[model samples]
Target: MKKNKTMVEIWQDVVEIKDLIRSIILSFIFTFGVYLFVSPNNKAKELFFGLVGAVMGFVITNVFIKPKRIIIFDKNKIKE
Candidate 1:
């Protein structure tokens, strides 16, 4: 028999996947940004710096922006 999962659980899975994709994009952007900064003629150096920047961006975002916000809801106002 298979267990059923709630909508919230499905949403959470989607959110996790989105986060993973975002991290990859962020890393790629960072790498490109670093390459622009270096302005190196050699492709190898540019790639190296870009990779470093990508890793840096990914780490920074994960460390500082991954936390969730807390909000409280009031039921009294809605129960007219």
Candidate 2:
């Protein structure tokens, strides 16, 4: 069965609304979760940890979620 996708344009890019929301939630969770582990007194540490968290979130999101788009190449467009 083919499932219909609900896509929307945000900042001139089209994305599935559901996936966008999921990405937001997951990134927030990972960012905040890791941020919480660092001591509150050190601002630099917090920033570093938060950035690491964001990267982790990006990687995890990519791992679990597949891209909804496909690219097609025109053979005639590129001639060797």
User: By how many angstroms RMSD does model 2 differ from the true structure?
Assistant: 2.5
Candidate 1 lDDT tens digits, 1-80:
13442222343443344555666677777777887986488988877887788778878768744533346786666655
Best by lDDT: 2
lDDT of 2 by residue, 1-80 (tens): 23887888787777888888899899998998889975375889889899889889999999977776687886776658
Give TM per candidate: 0.48, 0.80
Regions more than 4 Å wrong, model 1: 1-15, 64-80
Pairs in clash, predicted candidate 2:
none
Q: What's model 1's TM-score? A: 0.48
Report every candidate's CA lDDT: 0.65, 0.84
Alpha-carbon runs more than 4 Å astray in model 2 = 77-80
Clashing pairs in 1: none
Report how far off residue 49 is in candidate 1 (Å): 1.0
Worst 10 residues of 2 by lDDT: 1-10
